[model samples]
Target: GRPLRVHSTEDGPLRAYRVYHSSWLRAAVVAVTFSHLLLALIEPRAGDGESYYTSFGSRANEPPDAVRAGLGRDVLWAELVMLLLYAADNMLKVYAVGWGNFFSVAAYSASSMFKTEKWDVLRIALVFAFLVEVIVALSTDVAWRPLRFLRPLFIVSYFREVRRWVAVCVKMIPKVFEMFLFILVVIGLYAVLGNLLFFKSGFYADEELQNFDTIGHSLVSVFVLLSSENYPTIMNPAFFRPDHTGSVWYGLYFFSFLLIGLFCLSNLLVPILYQAFKHHRQRLALKNHVRERRALLAAFQELDQNRNGLVTLARFTDLVVRLRPDIKKGDEDAATIAR
Candidate 1:
């Protein structure tokens, strides 16, 4: 017998060992790929048949059979694309873990399994799901839009820890209402007093002034006092002659109510307006911060190669090194490259 010769590259024993070991892996890859392709084919069947190719083909004059065939082809193509995407996604999951880790693998596997089950009850389930999602999303958006505009103010309030301050203000609302009621009561009191003293014929007959002999005349007297108008005409007997004596006490009482009601009540609105203005300013600042942060994030993401969330120091260094080569070649000027 000739001497047995062995080649270094040929591992007869190991090759036989690998045949058994690699078989399951190769089978899984092929199975996943095929399943993905099938899923893709099925997905396009769900399309509305308004794809670009379908639209293009419809423009031409053709027999019914040809047009129908073309439409079918488009549907099949879309389904195939979807299936490929599905298969690729599944294959990546399978590659990440061996079949022995079935429990862990099951998590990623559920999407395809759920989708398959969903298709069985798709008509009713999909319609309901879509409607529910749309309604919920729209409702949330409607609720959020106004609040989003007021976010800056809300944040400022939070930062200042002003809930207690707001509570205090809220507590004062009833007191403010009571004060308003008091002002109304004072005005009514004066209106009635003036009507009795000036408008009644019996009261006016004894007074020297004949001017204050009507309801209209008494109302004018009350208006002048409420406005803090202290003209001597208000006290003259010609103004309220026959009905009653014009006392200095009337002017003093009317002026007191005017000062309390008009001046003090109007000043109360200042704090409310100040709070609103503060919130507006805070909101503008927050919006500017968000815009700036978004721009910075977009710039960083543009340079991210792997699409992982973080921009690493290594990635930054690599980008700088790559730019240096371009600089050396004068492909980009320093000023332009800086941007």
Candidate 2:
């Protein structure tokens, strides 16, 4: 039995990839991003900011009055224009690549348009914020407008070094969290000890409100003392009584806590984080290097057409000319690299 099928006509993915990577399109996005940031800087603050519209009725049938005024009017118009431009840019990419490819939810790879662009999440958020702004415009509320301040994040994708730095920071999150938890535990223990030892002391009782009367207060006092803030004043009551005589061991407790918590444990976190950053960066560099070697190997294999594991100089030159038609065959400068 013969099977009959109908084929659907659609733009090819290769063509879509080409269009999305067009230089002019990228340049336009950069220009718009810069303009958006510039406008954000001068954008008026809330309560201090003015609105271009006013609402007179609570009914849905009543539309807001469009009486434009102040710097807000121009800023609002510019924002709307930028929104439209951003939307158009995104739409063009979507139209070329189809909706699924343009708004991918899968893991990142070279072929995924959304992941490669690195702005899908932020751009989608920006679009939603625009919609919210329009809905809230009638009531003259612009609380969500400050989200535009994140516009500079879009520019980070343009720089490879910046992206690498961001990736390193992201990778450090878990380790940083663990270290923070460890520090909190150490502080908690110190707080409990301080509460037990100092609760009945003259130091805690002299204050209008007892600082070390309970675990909670002791925790706050110890944390504050960690910063060495007026520590001598705090240590005085424990150091010397009204008769100028007290046990030296009272002062020793504060000194020991400062030594272990402030100088030792707190400073230990720095070298640990530095090591983590260094390791992640080295791993990233290795991954990139391997990828480059694999690509070069694949290119070499393609050049060795006869499968002899070696490419003739003539063959290499011909392949180069074939790959880039603009490079004329007889150009020695272009062919020299084939050697």
Q: Worst 10-residue stretch by lDDT in candidate 1?
A: 142-151
lDDT (Cα, tens digit) per residue for candidate 1, span 1-339 = 111111122444224324323557546544543443343332222213343233233343432345554544554444344334433433333333322332333434533221121221232233244344334423342111111122122222322335445544555565466555765566567666666654543433554432356555555555555555553455454335555555665566546656764577546545655665566557657976876676667658877768987776555655554435435333345434444
Candidate 2: tens digits of C-alpha lDDT, residues 1-339 = 111111112435435545556688778888977887787565554432433332122232455434323455667777778778777766655655456644555514763323325555466666667756744652565433546556667566444567778888889988688888887887798788777778776565766433778887877777877777766656667776787756666667788888987898779889889999988988988988876776677678877878998888888888777545568789985578677
Q: Estimate each model's TM-score.
A: 0.28, 0.67
lDDT over C-alpha atoms for residue 61 of model 2: 47
Which candidate number would show the highest lDDT if scored against the true structure? 2
Per-model C-alpha RMSD? 24.4, 8.3
- Give the clashing pairs for model 2: none
lDDT scores of the candidates, listed in order? 0.44, 0.65
